[model samples]
Target chain A: MIKVSILGTGNVATHLFKAFSKSDEIEIIQVIGRNKKALLAFAPENKTTSDFSDLKESDVYIIALSDNYIKTVSEQLTIENKLIVHTSGSTPMNELSHHQRHGVFYPLQTFSKSNELDFKKVPICLEAKSKEDLALLKNLANLVSENVYEIHTEQRKSLHLAAVFVNNFTNHLYHLGSEICEENNVPFQILSPLIQETARKIETLSPYEAQTGPARRNDSNTITNQLEQIKKPELKAVYELLSKSIQATYGKEL
Target chain B: MIKVSILGTGNVATHLFKAFSKSDEIEIIQVIGRNKKALLAFAPENKTTSDFSDLKESDVYIIALSDNYIKTVSEQLTIENKLIVHTSGSTPMNELSHHQRHGVFYPLQTFSKSNELDFKKVPICLEAKSKEDLALLKNLANLVSENVYEIHTEQRKSLHLAAVFVNNFTNHLYHLGSEICEENNVPFQILSPLIQETARKIETLSPYEAQTGPARRNDSNTITNQLEQIKKPELKAVYELLSKSIQATYGKEL
Candidate 1:
């Protein structure tokens, strides 16, 4: 069995702990965090400690902390010649360079404390300094997730950036859509199927091929009408900018 | 049984044809379009007509044509006192006022010719002038879909606008994300799970609560880094504008 110790107790860390707990090939050695109360969620099932010095010797130490804390927290680990990895997309794997064997095990999914996710579907992006370390990390990742990739620092950075567009910015657009529905006394749930289909369409068709609506069609009439309907300045600005971008993207084809 | 005749053979028309053909309660009497070649897809199973003068008498006529063509097409129909509804989210119910009985049967989902959709989950927004007409449309909508809403012209207008943000603009963001993935030699599929999860999260949680990433966290370091990595002027502008919008939305809370 591969003994694993998880660092931090945020959403990512909690999720990783739960996923690893389900695997027969994996054993949770310890869960360490600065907050003693946050560590309580994992204490009943496995060892928990706020003190870094009390960390147990494990096959891998997964740091699932926030990006800002990753570098400082990894520095505090006194463990030598052990596999150390952070679950960050943007942060470089070298953030844990204090250790001889360092890598990254970033799960590319948004996590919430309340929502339960099937780890098997989540893509785990892995990176390591050595082939053996990479192989070991791959084994650990494969235990929970079916999708795993060897993503270097540069590629992971771009992936993280791409993720921001698809996840963060996309969610913001959802918020704006919800706002529009509310202003018209329509339930936001009406737009839910469209939202789901938009994401699902990309699985079969490219986003470029899947695109539709007034913006892509360059239907200035509907665009102008919709623009008049949007009262908020910020939302209006976003609508105008994105509509222009879509038109520009498909301008040649039009 | 409800006798229905579809006016256009577009994506919406074809999908509606396939859906109505499966329902025991919905009898698709005729499919009419100016383009004979487009109507061929539905000819063998159902009757097809190119001439509006040859239009079959049906309980309801569904104008599934383009937005601009909706008004003129409805005017062409010689049949009077029949429920003539247009399947348009933006077009007002009054656009079909050329007929004595007019209504709207707008399906709130993105449709593609290549993608086969389960109409059961599709939200069909219904609007009509007379109570009986709306009841008739609801019966037809219920024959195919489980989700139905009574959305008037104003509400449907806002819903259409919201659909553009969540569907059209959101798809554009996916295209941009794919562009980023391609530039870095990372398979765009790696980001698919994240995209799907982003949409799924909003089902249980509001988009405001589900929002994540650098902009939402106000991580200037990562945002600046992402801005620098973006080479294209249009993409850089989008990233900056969207990041600002996100920051503005959550600024008071932060």
Candidate 2:
């Protein structure tokens, strides 16, 4: 079995640790973190360490730390001429180019401390410096997930950008909706289904094809009325910008 | 059981027809459409002609048509004292103020023909001109859903605006992501988990609370690199706008 050392103790680390531990393909050789307190009493018998310098015996080294700290942690590690990978979608795999064999094994799913994730369907994005590293990354990804996609570092950057729009920006909109509800003394829960449905539709239909509403129709009256109704200046600004974009996309004016 | 007639055989109508049929809440009195073929397949006992003049009998009239059409269709109905409601989150209930006793029983869920909606969980937003109408709408919504919320027209409009951001605009971002992948000969499926996870996170955490990425961190190098990496003009524009918004949200600078 391939031996693996996982670094970091946050959401990404915890998620990968639990998922990999359940998998038969990889053995957890060590769980490394700077904080000894984070070295849980329940950690595996095979290995665990508080220092990255202590990790010398492993087939693969997986860095699950934040982007800012990855460079420092990678230098502290002892392993060389072996596969070293990070689990980040935005950070370039080449960020670990200091290592002879570097790659990325980014599970695209959101990780929360309390929530259990479905690894079987979750897409694992793999990127590596060379063909041999790619093969190793793919093999590890394939073991845990049915959806394994090989992405270039440059492409991953674009994908990451798109994800911010889809995820981060989208959630911001949900916040706007909730805020609107709060201002009006209405429960934001009312919009939850609509929010869910919008996402659900994108699974089967293209967003361009699925486009609807006053903005798409260029209903000026409704648009004006809506602008009048929205009290928050920031939300109103967002509404106007999005409405403009929608109009631009459709060749229809708002 | 309450008897209901559905006016309009569009996406909303079709989704509601099947959903209502599955629930033991109400008997569908009739299904009316502009096209004879669309209405022909509906249950004969429950289905009727497209003409509102030929509208036979029902306790409640649910106009599941478009916002542009709701006003026109409401004017078309001959019956006066009917408990009429339209299923639109964006359209104000006062739009039907000309009617004797009008209300909104908007199921604020996004509807797709292929996807089976979990009607029980999706919140049904209720509003009415009269107190009795409010109770009736709430009862009607409660039969099919556990989450019933009373939202005003102003808040619902804002919610609709927010929805356009999260659902429609977000999905558009997905399209952009997929398009960039297709152009670069990379599989778009790589971003699917990220997309799903992005939506899943909001179930527990606030959007602002869950925010993470280059934009939030003010990582200009990565932002510049991503902007240069993207080939499409629209995507570049979206990325720039969203990054600015995120920077603004996080009290960061470009």
* Model 2 Cα lDDT, one tens digit per residue, A1-254: 77888888888888778878788889888888877766673276447777666675787889998877888778776777889999887787777878889999887776777777787888788888889879888888787889888877776766666666676667666666666667777765566566666766767767778777677778898789778877767667777877777788788432
What candidate 2 keeps of the native contacts, as a fraction, is 0.55
- For residue B77, give model 2's deviation from the true position in Å: 2.7
Question: Which numbered prediction scores highest in DockQ against the true structure?
Answer: 1
Question: What are the candidates' interface root-mean-square deviations?
Answer: 0.7, 2.3
The first chain of model 1 has a TM-score of 0.98
Clashes of 1: 0
Provide the lDDT at B184 for model 1: 88
Q: Please name the candidate that would achieve the greatest lDDT relative to the true structure.
A: 1
For model 1 the local lDDT of residue A133 reads 98
- Worst lDDT window (10 residues) for model 1 chain B? B43-52
Q: Candidate 1 residues B64-91, lDDT tens each?
A: 9999999998887799778999999999
lDDT (0-100) at residue A2 of candidate 2?
77
